[model samples]
Target chain A: MADLIEISDPADPRLADYRDLRDVELRKSLESSEGLFLAEGEKVVRRAVAGGFEPRSFLMAPKWLDGLADTLATTDAPCYVMSEKAAEEVTGFHVHRGALASLKRRPLPSVESVLAGARSVLVLEDIVDHTNVGAIFRSGAALGFDAVLLAPRCADPLYRRSIKVAMGAVFALPWTRLPDWYEALPSLSAAGFTTVALTLADDAVDIERAVEGVDKVALVLGSEGHGISPRWQHASDRRAIIPMSAGIDSLNVAAATAVACYVTARR
Target chain B: MADLIEISDPADPRLADYRDLRDVELRKSLESSEGLFLAEGEKVVRRAVAGGFEPRSFLMAPKWLDGLADTLATTDAPCYVMSEKAAEEVTGFHVHRGALASLKRRPLPSVESVLAGARSVLVLEDIVDHTNVGAIFRSGAALGFDAVLLAPRCADPLYRRSIKVAMGAVFALPWTRLPDWYEALPSLSAAGFTTVALTLADDAVDIERAVEGVDKVALVLGSEGHGISPRWQHASDRRAIIPMSAGIDSLNVAAATAVACYVTARR
Candidate 1:
């Protein structure tokens, strides 16, 4: 059974992981990386527990503790029960959901491991927006994409905002970082994957026609402003574009990813 | 030629449309049904002008005015040429793109007119996020969705942030408010359209298999927290859901819209 501790003081050192969340908690410096990965709200916390991420500590209003009893019975972490007012003071903003948990970050799977036996994959190039990254993962997981591979510049999928925005899909979806994307491409191709680059260039085949025959496919998506670089474009097996009406630039990168993933995945 | 008016003072009455944009501009009630529709950057401003929403006025750095001279020749609106500093003060933020245009809100098309001859349509229910709404428009337009019908709770697509995020697709896409959604469904069915409601119910058919071979379709998407209301669920001709992994809840509304629109549109 979990250790239930009553916390009335907002300055408790054990509550440090949940403190000043809107500002310091969101920081991504090397020092803050030692801080716990925040799982906000009851739904995500329950998911984190289910995913085998043992909670170091939990802070929540007393009312919320009732709903979490079943999950808490199996955990050895200390659950810091606090008043909603005290909880708000420790955390910078109002946490309306009345619950939060901090878990230690675990080692991510390697690209090779995630890609093993995968038929369809999404390779993101420098997707900076956390929401877009999360949305892409949600869509990828939903549309039957086996794995997601992130290039160096992409936002961390484990980031708190990304995790929440992805509705816990990030926890279950297989993903890994490829520090050197160029070198990684050929290995993916050698593994029987057809590399499809998504771009707006004139010579690109219509996405509808591009995915008609390929069974094993890797869909490459680029950032909103600057698309996939010339090197990747040149190395791609085929370029596919979702046809648009004239005068429109392009769909949001995440939206485009969903369309591409849906089109390429087998129904 | 556009009348070139020089303004140095931030408090100038002529600059009212651009003042305190972070606060006043977002307040819909203050606009008195004649709210300013802002188009930022050179690209969106040009598109807005070409789309026939006459610019009421413009605040721009002198350097940008010279580049826009050819396009400005036909407009009668006064072009307020200001120093970069003054433009930033007037808008309450740095004018990074060096240009901004304020246009009067144009009348939205009637639902009947927007749906006329539409083979595929999207109905958005209570999606209040501006960026999500904007991305949905971009995806709908790109995927060849002929029209979008919005429920009353939907955000105004002409909001400034939405226009910027949408990259001006809002101006190009056909969207209108459906005041009477229940009443509109019979007409939609009468016009040979299959009303497909997207949900996560256990009995719902897979969206990919459900949409195939449908001639005319209306894909209905709901907000993030609450899925489609029971009213819509009961009214729909078919209930369909995008197949998702076991632990995942659902995709972002915009991402789901893209996937649904792509699957339902005439290929």
Candidate 2:
């Protein structure tokens, strides 16, 4: 069983992992360098442990301890209980769900391992918003997409915000960053997957037509500000558009990903 | 032509409309009581003006004036020019897009007028998040949904965050609050729309099959946390689900809206 320790001071060194949660730049570097990721809320905390991640520690208000008693029984990780105010001071934000876990991030598996026996996948290029990255993962997982591939510049799916927005879907999905960005689409095609890029290119066909009768499908999405880059767009096997109404700009990247994944799932 | 006024003081009363943009409660009451709404960035400002919203005033750094010169030339509203830092001090956040406008809020049209001759529509119930509301509008408009109807408790689409995330689609879309939330679905059905609620009920049909052969589709979605209320779910003509993976939870309300809109558009 986990040891429950009552801590009054927010500046305790044992609580270092939870500090500066709102500072994106600082948290990104700290998380990566420390080789750890945070899962916030009771559901995500339980999911993190259930996904086989070893917890370094947990922090929460005293009230949360009872609700998480069953989960706490499964691990020997130290649980630091504090007042909600103190927890907010340590984390730089209110702990809305009242529980958090700092878990070790294992080295990412190889791209081939993630794609093993997978038919439908999402290939995201430069989707740098953590929330968008999280949302896309949730959509892909929920709609039965088998795996995901992210470009080098894509935001980390394990970020606290991403994990929270994803509702722990990030932990459930198989994904890793592409080792080679330049030939990512070509490599997928070589592996016998037909890459359908979601873009507004002149030759783009309707989304349904692009994925029809494909044995293996890889749906490609780009960043928020721009659609797909010219290099990737041209290199993709099929370019698809969602056939939007005239005079409207494109859907939000996450929304587009959901639509694309839904269509590809049925295909 | 617009009159350009240079102001270095952040406390100027003329800038009241643009104050405390980050505080949701403060901004809501202030904006509603003042009978105005804010449009941030040069593009949204241009879109708001183009959408026929009268401008109460414009606030921006001097550098943005050149890019928005053509738009400013079309409005007689006073323009306040301040340094980026001073603008940040007034607005409580960095104005990344470098321009803002306070526009007059015209009374929302009746639900009947918004739905007049509309073949496809979206009905949102208690979707309180500005970002989600904005995203739903973006997806609905892009996918050719004719209008949007919101329950009385829904967040304001005219909020600045909503406008920014929607990419000014809120200005283009015809939307208004429903006077009667309890009978909304029945009322839509009476108006010849086939009310399709996106819920996870046990008997929910696949979204595609539910919308198949339907004319005048009114796609219904609920709030972020909960699915559709029991009343709305049972009252709708048909219940539909997106057919997600077995182990996964439901999609984010906005992502679900996007996918639902995509299917409904084709139907």
Candidate 3:
């Protein structure tokens, strides 16, 4: 069972993993350097443990201890209990759900392993928003997308905000970063997957028609501001557009992914 | 032509509309009481003016003046030119877009007016997040949904964050609050719409099947936390669900809205 240690001082060295939660750059560097990612809230923390992530430590208010007792019993990781105020001081934000876990991130699985039997996959290229990345994971997972392959530059799906926004979908869904961004689509095509790029190009066909009757589909999405890079756009087997109203900008990347995933899943 | 007034003081009364923008409660009350709404970024500012909203005033750095010169020439509203630092001090956040417009909020049109000749509509109930509301508007508009109807408690679409997230799609979309929440779905049904509630009820059919062959669809989505209320769920003509992977929670309301809109628009 996990040991419950009460911590009053927010400056304790043990609490370093949870400090400066609001500092994106700091957290990114800290998390990567330490090979750790944080899962916030009761549900997400529980999911992290259940998803087979080894917890380094946990932080929560005393009142929250009982709710997670069963989860704590499964791990020998130290659980630091503190007042809500102390947690806020350390995390630089209110711990509304009152629970957090810092878990070890395992080495990413090979792209080939994740795609072995997957019929539907999401390929993200430079989607830099953590929340957007998280939301897309949730949508793709819920819609039964088999796996996700992220370009080298895609936002970290394991970011704290991404974890919270995805409600731990990141843990449940199979995902790995692409080792080679340039050859990502062509390689998928060679692996018997029809790569469909979601773009606004004039030659783009309706999404419904793009993946219709296609087996082993790979749907590609782009960054927030500029869409899929010209290289990937040209390399993809098919270009699909989500038939939008005239003069209206495209849906937000997450929303577009949801719609695209739904269509691809159904197809 | 608009008057160009240079202001250095962040506490100036004329800049009240743009102050404390990060505080939701403060901005809501201030905007409502002053009969105004804020549009951030150069594009949103221009769209707000082009959407026929009367600008009460414009605030921007001197460097952004040339870009909006043509727009400012069209409005008689005062344009307050300030340094980027001064703009940040007044807004409580960095105004990276370098342009902000406080536009008059006109009285909302009747639900009947927005529904006239409308085939596809989105009805939101108690969706409190400004970003979600804005996203739904963008998705709804992009997918060719004719109108949006929000329950009385829904967040204001014209809120600065909402406008920015929606990319000013809120300005182009015809939306208004439903004065009567309890009778919302039934009222839409009475107006010849198939009130399809997006819920996870046991009886909920696939969204595509739920909206199939429906002439006029009023897709109902609930709040972020809970799905549609019991009353709204039962009052709707049919319950629809986006078929999700087993054991996964439903999509985010905005994502659900995007999928629903995409399906309904095609129907």
Order of candidate numbers by DockQ, starting with the best: 2, 3, 1
- The interface root-mean-square deviation of each model, in the order shown, is 1.6, 0.4, 0.5
Q: DockQ for all models, in order?
A: 0.65, 0.94, 0.93
Runs with alpha carbons beyond 4 Å of true place in candidate 3: none
Candidate 1 ranges beyond 4 A from true positions: A1-26, A30-32, A71-96, A212-215, B1-15, B19-26, B32-34, B60-74, B78-98, B201-203, B208-215
Model 1 deviation from native, Cα RMSD in Å = 3.4
**Model 3 agreement with the true structure over A55-121: per-residue lDDT tens digits:** 9999999888999998999999999999999899999999889999999999999998999889999
Cα TM-score per model: 0.87, 0.98, 0.98
Docking class of 2: high
Tens digits of lDDT, candidate 2, A36-67: 99999999999989999999999999899888
* Candidate 3 C-alpha error for residue A22, in Å: 0.9
Error of 3 at A47 (Å): 0.4
What TM-score does chain A reach in every model?
A: 0.93, 0.99, 0.99
- TM-score, cand. 3 vs. native: 0.98
Candidate 1 clash pair list: none
lDDT per model vs. reference: 0.82, 0.93, 0.92
Cα shift from native, residue A145, model 1 (Å): 1.9
